[model samples]
Target: MEEQEIYLLITRYLQKETTTEENEILADWITDSVDNEQTFEEIKLTWQHTEQIKLEESTIALARLKNRINHQQDNKAKTKKLVPFKWNAVAASVAIIGLFLVGLFYLLKPNDSVPTTYSVLKTRAGEIKTITLIDGTKVSVGPKSVLRYPSVFNNSERNVSLDGEAYFEVSKNPHKPFKVNTGDLTVNVLGTHFNVNASRNQILTTVSLLEGKVEVNLNSDKDDAYVLKPGQELTFNRANQRVFQRNLDSLNTLGWMTRTLNLSNDKLSDAAVKIENMYGVKLIFADQPTADTRIYAQFNGDSIEDVLTIICASGNLEYKKQGNKIYLNAK
Candidate 1:
């Protein structure tokens, strides 16, 4: 690559705008030689110093400076001794020019710090993991879930991305709100206890608020947002792009936390959905009537067989387990 292009690539890397392939290219260039590593460090410092300036201005300036240096080095390549000499003058020139521009450009503007390091919290099948974030917020990740969060939150807001199920008890901070990104949906909260289920296999992405308030934004649009209160649950249908809000027993949503299958006036179908997710088993209903049966029960860490027995006994239903599938029929 040309010297000008390499400087541009380094700028893109500093701004976190490089693709995976671009990152690989940068990594290779950095490890190619000691001079290349030193050049990278100098450019990094120059980039940091010129953070307040428009990116285009810094990029153009760096590209011009690099091209000049490269031309000077090529001209001196005929002299063996001169070629071995360090280019301290060139490095000093770049730094001085970068500092001058930093003073000239947006001096009073506050710098927005970007998160450079992130940690991913994942759980295997039948596994649950709990973690406290740097902000003192607690998160319980459910089975087969992935939660990607910054090691340290920025000054603006606390943000995390979730791929599956998780329960969040966010720490209260009036200035910085907590945001969870699930596909096209974003959940914003100041401080709240909420359970989010966005499993890939499930047709519905559900958010149940146990305490405090949260705003659910579809496609990151504020106008298409819904504010949910405690005891309210918001369900978004992925197929039709439709959303629904209903009041529900929010405590039932935290059953995974306590290892209990707690249902309060939940339909058989609803219970079946939870059971299927918890046990990694498929629940099939013989008829619609049997699936519509409502039940109110709590099983404290009971076995699947015992829970199924109690559930079937509560209504005129019989259940049979075949492999990983459980079939329910009206008795």
Candidate 2:
């Protein structure tokens, strides 16, 4: 396909004027590479933002859009032939112009709503914080986490972005659905108590529900949403994009909030993972046999040393700490 044709097709696709065949072609092209998908997202975001701006401010918006596109072009200069330079530039320009014209036509459009202002809440390592949103929704943010939410939710929906982990007690609002976006997945709820863990280092993003119900939607597959009830948990593997749901421990899910460590017949290696996350420490095993040991225990509001002592005593194991690193071995 020619660059110009692809650009026109993309422009038509964005305008919702594409035929089924054209849409299929565009979809195939986007799915062909990650770069194509990212480029499409950038153009889409720019087009959407332009629509929200007033006609009088369109010149500034256009300038910003062009600058952003140019910056992207510079970044992709070495691989210009990947998607064809003309296609990206032309598509971006056409989309921006189309949005500006649409905004102009809506100059007399009734202003029924105000824009939302977002605020960011964050917690550093070894820190935990609790916050109540404007809608009375409570969020308990875990260590090394960030939550970005609007000061006031939109009339139709409550949306927030989260990274790392948080326990959410959503305020019941039947008219407005609540959504928690964690980059690759979105958790939707009318009113629910749920815990979400989306740490960057982990291979899986987990959502554990304690009360009411919630729906989790994978960004890669919108139709593959998973609905969960209380006592259920959904895990989305980032590496393979696989999703699985199973029964979960509601109390254990809130362990971070209560300073409790629950290890119900867990393997030593698995327990080490929990300890590492909870205490922000590194666990080194002296040998494979020792690391494979199993233990069943619960440490409620116990110090790391105390918990380790109990584990070691139960399995006849030994451990020594050197700064932030702990080494374990069989006695």
Candidate 3:
């Protein structure tokens, strides 16, 4: 989670507006690290102090605090010698009070400025869904996917969490970049169209850009980031914690959106995953060689059996069906 979103969550927690799940999320984040715990404690303390002050005084007090902070920063920059640290009780108390008001000033802002809560959208196997966010961003969620987004985005940025695959058509807001948080990486964009395949079951997380530029960075190492231009794709391997980029194929990357299964030199194993995701069935190879065989095929709005039959024929393979599981072997 971003720092700004953390503040919004803390504010919601303080106001008793958080849901049970939200409370748990906040608790987990707080316990994740010492820095997170300290941040939560500081915000909690500041909120308590702010409650004692009148609401009308928040703006003036916050203004004064900003001015004081800016003045101190300027002084520190101009002076070469470090100032001696002396504990003045009165001055310290006044400074703490100033921060208290600053916290209140932000928390008490208009409702639209921050999200009071979040909503979760999920799609079952073989199902696809789409939603429009408060910022006019459109998201088409793929099968077996989960997406969590705020009711209203904070003024600074738009944040959302995703699991599985999603195609995004983000409304342009250069001032507030849109971010998608997946399990292993984050995709940052300033109003662009993109497809993110970060499914939990998949070992590789892929981010494909269709229209605009996007920055993909690993959660473990933010500095290890890749900027992808249009028609480019970035793949992050979770097992190796490595990333590689390649030119993206629109049909292969986004065919699911239109019920078009386009396989351009896809390995049999990889093609099986696509079929399983679309038809909610399981595919198993009888041998490793058959799984490794690559095939090129396309199926537009075809039934699961038809799609599998064509693939098996093209690869000189045969498949046996037992319930929802399909086993493939070399013919």
For model 1, how does the per-residue alpha-carbon lDDT over 99-184 read when each residue is reduced to its tens digit? 43332223322483333578899886567898766555779999878999985565568999998899998877776789999986
Q: Tens digits of per-residue lDDT for model 3 on 1-331? A: 6544565667766666776567657756764554455456556645755756675777665565456545664676544322332224324445444444445555444561432578899988788998766545779999889999986565467899999999999876666789999979999998899999998888999999999899988999989779999999999999988788999989878988777987778898877777888888899998899999888888988998898888888899999989889989998
TM-score of 1: 0.56
Where does model 2 exceed 4 Å of error? 1-117
Better of 1 and 2 by TM-score: 2
lDDT of 2 by residue, 135-192 (tens): 5577999988999998546446889999999999887767678999998899999888
The candidate scoring highest on TM-score is 3
Ranking by lDDT: 3, 2, 1
Instruction: Indicate which candidate wins on lDDT.
Output: 3
Query: Between prediction 1 and prediction 2, which has the larger lDDT?
Result: 2
Candidate 2 vs candidate 3: the lDDT winner is: 3
Ranking by TM-score: 3, 2, 1
Clashes of each: 0, 0, 0
For model 2, what is the alpha-carbon lDDT of residue 104?
Answer: 27
What is model 2's C-alpha RMSD? 17.3
Candidate 3 ranges beyond 4 A from true positions: 1-115
